[model samples]
Target chain A: MNRDRRQLVLMLMPYLVGLVVLVLLPAAATMAMAFTETDLIATSRFLGAANFVELTTDPAVQAAVGNSLSYLMFSVPLRLVIAVGLALLLHRRARGSGTARAAVLLPGAVPELAYGLMWLWLLNPIQGPVNQFLLLGGEGGRTALGTLPPQWLTDPEDARAGIVLMSLFTIGETFVIVLTARLALPPEAYELAELEGARAGQVLRRVTLPLLAPVLAVLVLRDTLMSLQASFVPTLVVTNGGPPPYATTYLSLVLYQDAFEYLRYGYAAAVAALMLGLTAVAVLIQWRLLRRWASHGIVGAGAQRPGN
Target chain B: MSWHDPGRRRRAYGAVAVTALFGSPLLLLLAGSLREPGQPPVVAPPLIPEDPGFAAYHQAITHGDLVRAAANSMIVAAVGVPLSLLVASLAGFALTQLPRRLASAVIGLSVLAMMVPATALLLPRFVLFRTLHLTDTLVPLIAPALIATSPLYPLIYYLAFRAIPADSYDLCRLADLTPMQTWRRMALPQVQPVTAGLAALTFALTWSNLLDPLVYLYDRATFTLPLALRALAAMDPHNQPVFLAGAVLTTLPTLLVIGVAQRRFMHSYGPEGAP
Candidate 1:
């Protein structure tokens, strides 16, 4: 009713417009598309439940869902441990941390397409430098991608591992955020622990780990959601979601295949909508679990100065 | 702190060994790219090639689509970053100044936006752009970026603005400046470091994006750098050397940008309240 209130509404208008157009509208369209059977062609009919039925009954969809679960199982813990270890190493600035950080971060900057291609070659069953070095040109020498490379891009177990390995290279964005959280911790806390004759491990346990827990939780939540929609580049470069007809098919890959490959716009939209729903659930779970950490990391910086 | 300390030295050596191990993949990439087909494969001796030639780089450069893609990428980034900065700064300033409950809601929504992967948005965005007659053009590519609608840049700017002391805004108000003027004169200067960091990242993202143009654009003439590399890869799957070379060329500008941005981040993290 007053000037401040009026001013607030006026200022918020632009952002509100953006939200409607950019976020809300597209999301709504996806939901609507999920319910139909239009192939991006002339006429479309409402085929509610039919698309949902197929999505659930489809064996390829089941395998993809299973592989995605396996991927989360392997990738999350692997990345968390590796990321924390690397962060700790860089945190101490032990000779070459800067350069190490930069190098590690370089992979994150690389597009998925590039990284996928690199892996496609690196994991190549024959003559890949990785397999070659491992085998040392003996009778055991064979292309890892061909002989022992696991069906990473194609087989269920291997495809999951492949996804994890591909993702391993791009931990930089998370590493950076975690580094920010680590650097933000009060050095005096570590200083005091040292003065008290604490061992390095003790200091890490007592001081660093608790301080970093919040950031790590935030990183996990963010990455999990991002991982759900992971497709396009990886699919294109490696398996193309093939071999057993549909071993490595993720929801996004399925959507792409349906839309671009099969011209099944209605089916693609349905898949897209499901993926969006999963993403939403992931975000909700993250918020419920990590809201305290997110708030403290962002807003409680000054208030938590006692640790200083 | 002393180099004479055996413990410190041991830790330093430990760090180096770990880094060398972790960093080997990138090195392996370089070495593998350089090894000529049919040559005896040796992982040791020199990580550098015996001849140390740039044949792969030469081929990558001469690829017809690459140069044009680079130009297109530059244009896309050059236009995208500033537009995002302006809109994000405005929205961030407004959001930060709002009432506590309202601000939390906005922040929550934005965080939710960030949590949803960008890939999920692609399909609807493509259809929407097509309906609007903007799909084949660069307009759809740049439009979402023009608003502070993107989660990544806006989120960074929001955090940066929030980090600045609120009293500065109060001081501006006391000086008789309007909110817009206050943002431009006071808040904008403070957030410059954050903007610069975001600028580098935005540029890198724009340059390396492979999917958007590949799907949206109808012609090779509009291809971005990553798409150019993808085209090359599709053309020759056997030439791992050429693929690696394209990857290198694609990543060079990104490395430079990250190099410049890291200094700002380091400075920001130096001797401060983590808050």
Candidate 2:
């Protein structure tokens, strides 16, 4: 028994070192730094929630927080709706549908930075084809990146809209996840619905949607946390978080600027901790709500294992 | 044959039209890159310009720091992918082998790390790397893989490993294989599909990542393709064709990689499994 314990401890040694050096230490450092005020050159003085107080009252932080929340409110449901609709529409095994699905998903595989840059040019207000095409319809002469030209990165209203729209193109990841779940649905359930002479939409609502709800929730929670990161490249390139008071500043970008650019290590650490707290709360809620929906029965049928 | 039937023919025509319409955007994007700026934007022009010069490609090769960045990226990826695979497989295997309590904690931590957006790690990681003197080198970028802290690859490998049965481990042990031998001769073969999937994913993540290198590397010459492309975009946002050209160059490798990997992916991740 002693030998077994030793062996087990030995096995865990690497993980422990890794956890301490990579995760725990950083977490501890960030937590401690949150209470202090230090630039790179000097020792930090304990500030005792002064930073948090400032964070609460600062209009920039407030706008950032509001923008993030509003972004979540809009993007999550919109992505869920569009992803499910697209998955349902394209999940068929018809000729060339798989290829079509692959093509649509190609956008997701492209690097986020590359895709962001591509869209930056493609959505340019004056020169971009998107706006040019929009103008052809004579829709009040508003360009796609004009004062409110679906400005995916600038105007506050349009920034939220743009983030959501940009997310729409990357639905390949969510689409594939949902597609697997949709395919895994027992054919018998659909067969019964078909026998009942149910319409497609009815079967989708009653059978497909209900069964896939768990995966949908997972996707929503996952994307919400992800978009909370706000994809730095897009925001950085598209808006530069600009125009005034930095409306598009995500928690990560703010942290990055604080730590690296300004060398306010402590402030950056505080931002990191806040972001961590936010994700933790969101994740906890998701875990509690999503436990029931996780029953997708693993994909491959095989010998049973001890722990999932 | 369907011409005699209006409804069938109309549906067929509609399918064709939709395919063409949907396909046109991608095609136009590709076609637009090839067109010079002086040409009228509306007209469908040559697939290759009249000059058909390799100017963009040449510029990308000669003037751009693409080769070095590509080298750095490859080095990072080559080292990082295997490191991630090994760490994930080890933790995954041990989690299955260990007592219930330890396993749960391990799994919990892994899942928690996976769920946290990688952006959250940037500040902490930059600070950590700075202290270690690993910042600015490939180590900071690559070493994250060794710990399975790469938010993307670790989750992918964990899912893949989970799909494998515990019996595979026992089978290798019973065959008198050493742990290393077992990994090579048995477990590796069984998880080939997942390995391929994770490999592609690791490549995608490494190749496309702009944040880490941007933070760590100060010199423009050290920039990866994505970083270089971003730099190019910043230099001249108004030069539309130049941006497209850079985008295409940046996109080419991954596109080719996906084309090749898609077959393996299709086989491994059946139409039924998650990508």
Candidate 3:
């Protein structure tokens, strides 16, 4: 090999080894391990399809799957819309926009564990300021709207909603990307929109959305995967898979419990296999939905240019 | 852009609303931490305590063993983040040098790797570490650094490095610089904003990571900050203030790191007054 080839290999060796060892090997091993009954202590026994068969009948698995899908359904769209809205609103300098921008990003800067603990207090349902503020207006345990406050920790539905609520504030990464995309667009289009005296809504509909579709498409795909697995921390820390019967027990929690708590490695590997399938299906669905938009987003990649 | 104009005034109001709505949780954390110790979970307590105190923070640090856990967290992040950046930046620069097809294939593989969620790999990693007898040690926690914490970092670096003009590489060749030399001296210096932003994120993520520590570690001595915080809550479920204090301590460093990088990062988005 030439010097260039040797140099390239030398540089690429670490990443290639890392990708294979950390990702590819584990992925393939998960499939194989799904067939065996091993708990890291005993001799491995090939269970054939038994682990997968049991997965089909487990109510816990069923509930975990349902919770994950519901979490994904609600959180992904809400996060996307909010992130894009914030990016569009605060992308430019104006009075107090920097504060708004900082507000948008600061929650994301928070560590997940810290953020989870913060929500544990904020959504405490009893002593939590959220419910307390809601209850302040009424005589009894009701709010001024003649409704009761949400039981964010105890009630099943509210426990799920609280997780999604915690998720909404941490869209800093998404906001930054969308803001850069907005900035990177050819200024001539916006200049033309201004020359034509386009209303803000009109410009958004006709000019901005189409240009940003590509970036949004990618965010949708990435956020879909993120929303699915993002539940591990919250469910573990705040909810503990509770308001029980696995209401907030997402797939990650299920996999975590099966492998780590129960020491059922093979069964957890099967759950992991199912998660991989879910991820593929989710990404494929979004890809088909947004194929046109994603195709052209990478060329310029929202980088800063010389001429605005 | 002045708030005196009607349109701008409406937006300023909008800004205030989001800043209040989304930013209130941190305030709640702060308030809960400041309450006097031994107080019951109060109903509709005032936002500020009549007499705020740091007794909860004191309890959290001593009884919760937070100082040791925090030191462990610092050790992991300090060692792990730089290693991650090194591997990611090297492969990213190498991508710029590789033939286009090979580079695209590698990039495609990297994207696929990113899509595989960390949860999916938990058991295999556990088995791998156990087989190597690295469990209960800090190696499992730090091993992810070799993968750049996520496969996404290399791709981000690839995009940033590719944005540089071809003439710069030509200049490097003319100056008799090797690939590694050009990468360190020329390419790295040009993309300080991206490096700073990515480093801040990597640090924050590493510091906050709870899952690996939860799975691999059982000894209290090896627990990182998040695990220690969880243990604090579990130890005294009724004492919410102590755990809240622990949460506050975890957030400050991550926020400070991001604040240091935010100005350069914000400038990279565009010069001020883009409109």
Candidate 4:
């Protein structure tokens, strides 16, 4: 290497070491410990896929996987759609637009613990503004239209929906990224749509959505990966994994409780391994779905542009 | 809003409505915190307390050890964010300067590391820190600074630095500046927006990080703001007002910093998207 290249390497050394020590080594340990039985105190003995075998039959693990996937099913796509919608709606200059942007970011700015606590208060069955709004014109915990209030704490499906609802408002980061991307689009494209006298719905469906597809695809994958672990604090705080039968148990919470609470470090390592596997599967599924869409969307958008 | 046509008029309505919907939670937080401590969740309690007071905030501050926790959090953010920014910028600038084969390898490793689920690191990192006898100290909490809080940061920096016109690099080389010098004097200033954004993000992440402190901190004095709030949340269910006060205290600093920084870097993406 040349002298200058060596200097650059020197600068890279610290972060590289940090990556190896903090992330990679622990990752490898998780892989290795998945086959062992230890609790950070005992000498681990290799049990050779026994943890995996147990994991296959572990009902808690299965429920957690289901809960996590169900959350992703609802949250990831909804967050993206709402983020895109908010970006499109408020990205343009208007009165209260700046505050509107901050409002979207507000929930996300709060710490996870605080945010979870806020949701805990907000999802309170009787006094929460959510239920209060629902119960406006009626009494007995029923809405004006007589629908039952969502029991965010006790009911299994309602707990799941509550978690999903909590996840919805924190689309701030996604909203910002989408807003930036929205504002950055070549205005000429919009001008062309205007010259073509395209209606708002058509312009949105064709021009905006297709053009934003690439960024949205990347965000979808990112959000998918994050949502796998994002429910840890909220689930722990709000529902504490449910009214019964582990309704809202997520992988991160499961992993934490197993390792820390139950002192099953090795088993938790197994759970961690399970989480990694699920993440891979989730990403693969999303890639398959979005890869087809991104390519087609981009090509279609380009063709729809005036020059093309 | 008053002058623009139907589109702007509609946008104004939408903006106001969205703000109301999105902003209600925080508003509720303020209202709830103003209530008397230990008030039960009554069906149809007034949205604004009839007799709002500072009692909850006072109880939260005195009872929750929040002042101490806030100081610890400030310390962590102070130490962690700059270190993270430095490590990330250096590594990112280095990536842009490294030979192509080496750069690609490093970039690939970063992405792979970034892809590893954070939960998977919990047990092993805990054990690692325990083995080093660093578990109870604030060091493990700040150790994430070494990774720039997230592996993605360096790559973000790399993208920003690489966007600088090649002639800037050429100019540096013509001046015979060392890579570090060029990175410090040239590359750094050019990517101010990225740096500002990343700093806000890093500080927020470091400040709000609960997982690390949850695993590592046992002592109340050592707890960061989020962990302290978690402790406060464990109180009697009726004491909701105190915890809400705690939440508000926890969120204020992060909100102000990001709010201030967002106006600077977030609104403009210069040159690329102009009409």
The residue-by-residue lDDT of candidate 2 on A1-308, one tens digit each, is: 45544554554456556655666666666778888887856777999887777777766566667777777787778877876766665555444555656666677776777677666755665555565665553545654444334544456766656656676666766876786677666677777887787876687677777777756776877787777775567777777666456767767667777777788776666677777777778778777666644444321111122232
Better of 1 and 2 by lDDT: 1
Across A1-308, the per-residue lDDT of candidate 3 in tens digits comes to: 27867887798888899899989999889889999998878898999999999999998899999999999989999999999898887776677887888888888887888888888888888778888888877768998988988999999999999988888888999988998888777778777887888888888887777778768878988888887789888888889999888879999889889988898889989999999899999988877666544455532333233432
lDDT of 1 by residue, A1-308 (tens): 25645565565566666666777777777778778877767687899778988889877677777766666667777787788877776665456666666767767776667777777777664545455565554454344333543434446556556667877767877777777778777767766776788876777776777777756766787668767665447866776776567766677677777777787777777777677777777668767756575565633443466633
Candidate structures ordered by lDDT, highest first: 4, 3, 1, 2
**Per-model i-RMS:** 4.3, 5.7, 2.3, 2.8
Error of 3 at A137 (Å): 2.6
Judged by DockQ, which candidate is best?
3
lDDT of 2 by residue, B1-275 (tens): 11223444444444444346445445545554565643434432343456643355545455556677778777887787777666766655455445878767766775566555555466567767888887668787776665664544444544665567778867865776654455457656777766665666667777787878888887775676777777766765655456566677777777677767667765554556321
Error of 3 at A17 (Å): 1.2
Provide candidate 2's TM-score on chain A.
0.83
Candidate 4 achieves a global lDDT of 0.86
Q: Least accurate stretch of 10 residues (summed lDDT) in model 1 chain A? A: A141-150
Model 2, chain B only, scores a TM-score of 0.77
Native A-B contacts reproduced, model 2: 0.25
**DockQ of every candidate:** 0.38, 0.33, 0.64, 0.63
Off by over 4 Å in 3: A292-308, B1-6, B270-272
TM-scores for all candidates?
0.87, 0.85, 0.95, 0.95
Cα displacement (Å) at residue A157, model 1: 3.3
Task: List the global CA lDDT of all models.
Answer: 0.69, 0.64, 0.85, 0.86
